[model samples]
Target: MILLGIVLAGAAVCVAVGIIADNTAPATLTVFGQHVPGVSSEAQVFVAGVIVAIFFVMGLAISSLALGRSMRVRQELRDLREEREESLTALELERQQLQRELARARGNQRPTTADIPVAGHRKRDQDPVSPFFDQSA
Candidate 1:
C-alpha cells in the first residue's frame, strides 16, 4: 500500500513538471559551458517521457524494498531451521544416554533358562536343578 502511494505521487509529480515545462517559454541555461534549452509545449512527447521516467524510478525503489524484505525473511527461516536441528540433536543425545543407563541397570541381574532368573533362586538352592533336570526325555 505504501509503495502504491509512492508510485501515484511520483506520477503526479511528473505530470505537474511536464505541465509547468509546457507553459514556460524556452530559456537557455549554461552549466559547465554546456547550453541546456527548456522543453517547449510539445505535450504528448514530453508527458510520455516524464511518465516513463517516473515509473522507472518508482520500479527501482520498489524492487529494492522487495529484495530487502525477502532477504530478512530468508534469514529468519534459516535461523528457525537451525534451532530445530539443534533441539532434535540434543533430544537424541539425551535419549541415547537414557538407553545406555537402562542397559547398564539390566546387566546386574543374573540369567536363567528363561533368560529371567526367578527372584532369590540361590537362597533356596541347596541342589538346585537346571531347567531341563526334571524334563521327561
Candidate 2:
C-alpha cells in the first residue's frame, strides 16, 4: 500500500508539472472583484493541488492513528478477558481444595448426641433443668 501511494503521488506530480509547463498563457486571478497580481493560473492550480494533498495526507495520518488506538484497545481487552478467566479458574481450584479439606475434617470427627435432633422434641426442651422447675408445665 505504501508503494502504491508513492507511485500514485509521483504520477500526480508528473501530470501537474506537465499541465503547468504546457499552459504558458498569462492568466490573472480575481477574488471578491479584486485582481491578484503576479500569480499565474498554473501557480494557483498547483497551490490548490498542494492544499488538497496536505488534507489527504492529514486524513490518512488521522485514520492510521485511530486504527492503531483501536487495535491497542482490542489487545488490552483480550488481555483482561484472559486474566479474568485465569482468576476464575484459580478461585474454582481454591474452592474445591477448601471443600475437600472441609470433608476431610468432618470425617476425622466423631458424631455427638448434640449433633442429632430428637423426634418430637425441640432443642430447648432437651436442656437439663432442675426437677423443681416443672418444665413440662
Q: Give the TM-score of candidate 1.
A: 0.43
TM-score of 2: 0.51
The Cα error of candidate 2 at residue 27, in Å, is 5.9
* Consecutive 10-residue window with the lowest summed lDDT within model 2: 27-36
> How accurate locally, in lDDT, is each candidate?
0.64, 0.66
Position 31, candidate 2: lDDT: 40
Q: After superposition, how far is residue 68 of candidate 1 from its true place, in Å?
A: 1.6
lDDT of 1 by residue, 4-113 (tens): 64766576666556545554333332333433355334565465457667776676677677778879999999999999999999999999998888878998454556
The clash count of every prediction, one per candidate, is 0, 0
lDDT of 1 at 127: 54
Candidate 1 least-lDDT 10 residues = 26-35
lDDT computed for candidate 2: 0.66
Point to the candidate with the largest TM-score: 2
